[model samples]
Target: MTELLLVATGLRKSYGQTAALDNADFSIRPGEVVAVMGPSGSGKSTLLHCLAGIVRPDGGQVRYRHRELSEMSDAERSALRRDEFGFVFQFGQLVPELTCVENVALPLRLNGVKRKEAERRATEWLDRLEVTEVSAKRPGEVSGGQGQRVAVARALVTGPRVVFADEPTGALDSLNGERVMELLTAAARDTRAAVVLVTHEARVAAYSDREVVVRDGRARDLEHAA
Candidate 1:
């Protein structure tokens, strides 16, 4: 088996009186792409949040490599999130003032990487995603698909062990959605990074190695295909 990059056992979460995640179990191996599927209010986003260490879990364990992130202090978990996990949301969320390459290099720069080197790495990843042509364009200057591609590049430039993407293709039409899924799956396989993506679309889930359906705050049926 590939090295285990992340593990969540008996994962649980709650929002005031509502239970978001109820004793969910999850595991991701390096180079694996896991798609999480669920209808709205099924706790898919909460699970992703807990896995990314953005929100604290009510109970259970979440480990990134050998580190038990679930029990870490806020500052400690924040550092772990910065160094180990990458995130891509439904929207690109890029800074309109910065060019695509600059936005892609942001995380690397925040990690104290030199600007020139960071941009260099950013260009490489962007090219891999086939968005190098728009490297100089700002987010507002590009199409929705293009901007989302830039966001994917930005997420990967940091070389994180795991990437958590929530509805990454939700804003795109079918053609662009398929294109984005291709890029995401390719990135996971090529970089040996575990990818946990949340989507309700079967087409999106088809791009992953495995899909876990979320229901009633827990993982239910699962499907797997290479």
Candidate 2:
């Protein structure tokens, strides 16, 4: 069996009277791609945020390598997020002023890598994602697909253990979305990183090795649901 890299047990969260997660249990193995699918407001994004340590659950625990995230200090959790996780969002979220290579190198720079070395590594990822031609272009200067490819390159440049993507291809057309999923999964696989993908589209979820469906603040394995 593959080693488990992340686990969430009996997670619970709420915003006022609305529950975002209710006793949710989920796990991810190293190098596995797991998709979270559900209707909007069903708490899929909340689950992803909890798993990524961006938001602490009101109850239960999120463990990464046996260390409970809820027990960590804010600074410790922040460091863990920066060192161990990557993220891709629907809008790509690349800096408007930074060129493609610069955007990709930002994470490495945050981790204390020298600019020259970071750019070199960033260029390699850009080439891998087939966005090398856009290396000198700013985010606003490129097509949506090209910008997204650059975002993927950025997310993986730091060699994180996990990638948490929320509707990563939501803003793209079918053809572009397909291409992004292919590259994202391929890159994560190549780097031996687990991916927790949150998407509403079945076509996007199909890229994952396993699927979990969220409904009414609960999550269940798709296979188990059948």
The prediction achieving the highest lDDT against the true structure is 2
Error of 1 at 76 (Å): 2.2
Model 2, 48-163: lDDT tens per residue? Answer: 99999998899988899999998899999999888889999999499998999999999999999999999999999999998899999899999999999999988899999999
lDDT of 1: 0.87
The 10-residue segment of model 1 with minimum total lDDT is: 217-226
> Cα miss at 54, model 2 (Å)?
0.6
12-130: candidate 1 lDDT, tens digit per residue: 88888999999887778888899999899999999899889998888988888888885689899888778878889999489889999999999999999999999999999899989
Any idea how many clashes model 1 has? 0
CA lDDT scores, all candidates in order: 0.87, 0.92
Assess the local accuracy of residue 1 in candidate 2 as a C-alpha lDDT between 0 and 100. 76
Give the Å error, residue 66, model 2: 0.7
TM-score of 2: 0.96
TM of each candidate vs. truth: 0.94, 0.96
C-alpha root-mean-square deviation, each candidate: 2.4, 1.7
